[model samples]
Target: MSVGLVIRLIVLALLVAFLVSPQTFVFVFRPLVRAGQPVIYNQGSLIDLTLNHLAIVGTAMVLATALAVGLAILVTRPFGAEFLALSRSLANIGQTFPPVAVLALAVPVLGFGTAPTLVALFLYGLLPIFENTLTGLTNLPPTVTEAARGMGMTGRQRLMRVELPLALPVILAGIRLSTVIALATATIGSTVAARTLGEVIIAGLLSRNTAFVAQGGIIVGILAVLIYDGLSAIERMLMRRTGQAGRQA
Candidate 1:
């Protein structure tokens, strides 16, 4: 096997082993702490947090996609384009607010729970998705769009069949960006007593337990890597299919 492929396999094996281990954390499982480790807790709190991260990130992704697509479509028109600068400015503001602060403010109104966290995440996720969708749509070759219009295609038909397919890759890239940000930020949710992997880190930090923090942080890292990679694989597959179909006679 190629050296790069072999290394990749080894890393994947280690990640899967650590993920499935009873200790559920590398620090807790270590005896002397240098590659060889013993199991501690036969439970997986980190896995639970990983699951929660997925939920938060998924929710953010849905909101981001809807908002970005809406804004992209709206701004494409002459009259609506008047508000393009304003729309982008508002999106910029959403991201400018510190997510933790946003969560803190949301707590009283939404209560101290996942609802506030999701709200923060949704705002955090919006700008990238919205901007990319707009860029992708506007960058479409004029000739191709003109041909679609010449074929008696309605606006919706051109958007759904011709324009959106061309823009799909960039749209998915926005989703990938939002996913990673949400995973990392979701750790903060533990501060508000949310039932996420953040719980492990906060508990450990409060108690000065390195094992808890390391375990929680590492699991979240792995979860982000895994999800990002999984989505990338799906994106590549879809892109290949679309490209091949677009090229066929």
Candidate 2:
């Protein structure tokens, strides 16, 4: 079969698995509810879960980008590159720690609620965005930068005009990855008593309700797909704009 056809078949199979049984049965878990009220996964509950999740993830994205990009820029300088090894070590360590363990540890300092969740997401998101930002800037033609400076462009002007536009796609890829992962991890926040779709999954497990688990898990999957795809679309648009700008200049 053609590659596109194979992909289409795979997607169809996945859709069927999700909609039907066996997959939802969760061999490791049993059904939670029976008849009447099975922790109903309605529009309202999902909205409540999703909205709070979006807030936490969005906040993390902003914070991660700011810190990652800023630090990447700072560390790219000769003085800063001296500390690159240390910077990379710290980022690697941050990602290596288990998120639940981190959350449990942070609870004492950050207290409960969305704050801890946001902190967790922000830290988790840092490495990808930071690494990609550093990579893109470093990969830029050194001669291009020298030429811009030779043309009397200020540091700010060179960065805004040359570095940022060129580096945007790689940075966006990192951000998109961060966003989807944050969406998945945000579900764990519900376990910590944060308001999130994970509440449904947790409650289902607590009460032995498969329906609740399926509903929550399914919604989260859907949300992740939409958000990732949306970010990718934005990245494509940005890339196109970059190309057009380069052509124009």
Candidate 3:
């Protein structure tokens, strides 16, 4: 494993320990709490809150990836090429609206809790993934694709075995970007009764507790950094494999 990965794991372990026994952080948080307030955030278990936050983000990302990648693939095909403009416009529409606005509009229709958050994040994440997938698919080398066809590879075979493999690194780059953005943005879900680390930050803000804000911010920041680094490593590995395949061929 990479040094960064190891370090991230260590940080994650420490974060978990802190969350499990937040009182262990008394020395740090005690000073930040108001004169009469307790050192720990007792509203909910941090572990539970973090898990719920990840669930919301993960669900949104999965939905976004499926829609974005599927649409990109469709638009890249000869039969679907005419839809390119429409696809781009649709993805742009998702991004053009702010997440908060999306949430506000969705809440009345979807009701409170995770639904609105999921909708907001799904829309927020679509543009990057779609754009990157489009770039990856459209930018493949013509010679390589022609060779696949010359070798009697069917279109589906060429797409699955040749094009997508080469384009994976680029696609993964989009996923990494989308995931990071969703991680930060998911915190906003707390406003609509979603259980998230954002609840801690919001509570802190409401009660004037700097400790709560710091703890929430630190956990979210750590999660984003770790996930980003992990995806980058995966992308690099994919790129290296593609390079090796090209050399051997």
TM-score of each: 0.83, 0.80, 0.95
List the lowest-lDDT window of 10 residues for candidate 2.
Answer: 21-30
Q: Cα lDDT of all candidates, in order?
A: 0.75, 0.77, 0.91
Over 4 Å off, model 2: 1-33, 37-39, 42-44, 244-249
TM-score of 3: 0.95
Once fitted onto the true fold, the runs of candidate 3 whose alpha carbons sit more than 4 angstroms away are 1-3, 244-249
Predicted candidate 3 versus true structure: per-residue lDDT over 91-114, tens digit per residue: 887689988999899999999999
Ranking of all predicted structures according to lDDT, beginning with the best and ending with the worst: 3, 2, 1
lDDT of 2 at 167: 87
For candidate 1, lDDT tens digit of each residue in 1-249? 877556656766776676566444445446423342223322345455566667877877798778877887788866588888888886776589998999889999989878888888888888888888888789887889999999999888998899888877777877888888889898898788676778767766666555666767777786677667767767677668667335433
Tens-place lDDT per residue, model 2, 121-225, is: 888998999899998888887778899999999877988899988888888889999889988998889777789878878877887777778777876786687
- lDDT of prediction 3: 0.91
lDDT of 1: 0.75
The true-versus-predicted C-alpha distance at residue 196 of model 2, in Å, is 1.0
* TM-score result, candidate 2: 0.80
lDDT of 2 at 247: 44
